[model samples]
Target: MSDLRATFERDGFLVIPDFASSEACEELRDAALRLVEETDLESLGSTFDAGGQRHGHDPWFLGSGGEVRAFLEPERDGDRLRVNKLGHALHDRVPLFDRFSRDPRLAALVAELGLAAPLLLQSMVIFKHPRVGGAVPAHQDATYLSTDPSTVLGLWFALEDATVDNGCLELLPGGHRLGLRSRYRRDGDRTWTDTLSDEPWPSDGWRAIEARTGTLVAFHGLLPHRSRANRSSRPRCAYTLHVIDGEAEYEDDNWLQRPPTMPLRGFV
Candidate 1:
């Protein structure tokens, strides 16, 4: 555990193989597929483009922080309903997701990583569907989920095999030490990004993380990471949970805000 902590501190990210059983991973994938089938595609008009210039301020997107909702991919096959992701509150709203998020193993992992009083802030199911899955722009998690002293940690679990050909995560090693590059915040009805640094990502040294099913990759808030578009026939499904130190001040202006009725939770 000490070695793992040291490695995480040094690289700003750590990958644990077979963190969850294959059966558990399949269960989560089945749940995500069920969510897509249960959703009313006719009523959902929002198309989520992660790399789009616009900071997502649409009511459907902004309001999803406290609810479970599905967003569509920007491009779609003829008559096919392509959902990009189901996000923001699955852990709080869905029973299976809730159990997975609050698992004892995860709680102990957070403790081992030295996050005292960790609060689970947000969760998402990313469906990098074949062909139309959009590329995610390189960005820091702290830019959107900001907290004082910046202690956000991201846990990404691969429900399906994540390969280089299927949009696996690509990260810049030790990039978290470079500090936050920007802040994404909302001002009343408007949302914008405040640039903190103009530093560019290095042209080299990027590492592609091809993970097997049930593998868990944990990364720092300031770590720079992104995934390419999935051009293969396979789908890259992942469940992600973001946690922050409860001792830190969560900024009110952060784009993702839960209503007073729903408070942040921790793995118990």
Candidate 2:
């Protein structure tokens, strides 16, 4: 295995080429497509984590069936409903998803990087549809995943080619040194707000992470990264697995804290 620790430390993100086999990529892509076709749009409100705690569903594209179709193209008669993403915690939905999320390679990297035992808490299949894919604003993963010392990492696996035209990821070099820029906290019973930093984004330091299928892009939680809307005809699809250091106490005030349903899974 390549020594990713040095590169990851230098840039705050490292793109490992051919990190997964072709068969693995194809299997994951097929599984994601199947889920998109079968998932119920209305039942998203009750999505659950592996621990069986309630987690809200992130919006999906629900695309039209065509070689090159917009995310929201309505002919009114009928369509093959496609989904854009499956998230907050989708690992336990199937054996495939669960296994992939906790792949041994991921855990090894976490250990090599000198991080504590890994605790995977969330997973996602982000689909950037052909035309109407929306842009994800520049932000740190720490805003959504708040840990005490903030030792979370994001592992993004490309299911297809990711390019600038298809909204490939753009990351700031060594941005993790700045730490978290936004904080999400509950106000009272139901309200929550994100307090973002007043400092301007380092747009000049941004660089595109154009990856091929089966590539893995591992980024630090505090790294500032973003992706634009997919304007090209090709769809951009990927799986995002978010992991955090398991050695710390997950605070009660953190917005994303979920009740433990089972023991945290780790790898050697």
Candidate 3:
């Protein structure tokens, strides 16, 4: 754990291989598939971007969203409900997901890192569906999660092997020091204008952080990263959870908004 902590602090990310049990990974994978079958993607509203492309917000945009999700097929990028990513927060809505979010191992890791009382801020399931999967534009997590000092962490658990061919996460080392380059979120009915920073992603030092099934990866909140389209035969599934320092001041206009009556859950 000390080595992992050092690597994360130095590089802005760390991948811990074979951290979870195969049984646990399979259970979460099964739960995700069930969610896909049970959800109605169209119920979530869609808005057009400046380029006239229909962009669908995460399940948080629609109060009833997050049960399941899909990505728009870039080839036929229209109003399609093609599945890709699962959510901004599922623990608040799903029993199985809620359990997954509170994994003791993750809690221990946060404590070891010396983070202030870790709070569950967001949870998501991202899919790199084969062939028609789309590329995620390079971005920073803090773009959506706006904390005053911006102390946040991201945990990505690989439910399946994520290979370079299947759109594994690629990151730029120490990118968090760039201090958040953009802010993309909903402003109104047709808001797609995103703010940018002078600091741009380095054109080099990018490497894929592939993981086998049951592995976990940790990254800094402001790290700049993205993934490619999965052209491989099988799809890759990953479970992602985001945490914030409980003592930090979280901005009110974050893209993922919590209800006024809701409280952040303690992890460690």
Candidate 3: list runs displaced more than 4 Å.
41-81, 185-196
Error of 1 at 171 (Å): 0.8
**Candidate 3 pairs with clashing backbones:** 70-82, 70-83, 70-84, 71-82, 71-83, 71-84
User: For each candidate, what TM-score against the reference?
Assistant: 0.97, 0.81, 0.85
Quote the lDDT for 239 in model 1: 96
- Of 1 and 3, the candidate ahead on lDDT is 1
Which regions of candidate 1 are displaced past 4 Å? 53-55
lDDT of 3 by residue, 1-268 (tens): 5987777888998888998888888998888778777767565343222123355343434332233333334343244455666665676667777887787888888877667778888887776667756677787788867688887888888898998999888889987777777665554333243667675578899988888998888889889888887888878889898898888887755655566666677762
lDDT per residue as tens, model 1, 1-268: 5998999999999999999889999998899899999999878888887886453768888898899889998788677879989999999999999999999988988888888999999999999998887888899999999999899999999999999999999999999898889998897667888998898877788899999999999999999999999999999999999999999999999989899999998886
Q: Global lDDT of each model? A: 0.91, 0.69, 0.72
Tens digits of per-residue lDDT for model 2 on 85-200?
56545565457878887777777787887677788766777777777555677888887677788887898999888999999999999988886766755322332435566887
Q: List where candidate 2 sits over 4 angstroms from the true fold.
A: 1-3, 42-82, 187-191
C-alpha lDDT (0 to 100) for residue 254 of candidate 1: 93
Clash totals, every prediction: 0, 1, 6
Better model by TM-score: candidate 1 vs candidate 3: 1
Quick one: how many clashes does candidate 3 have?
6
lDDT of 2: 0.69
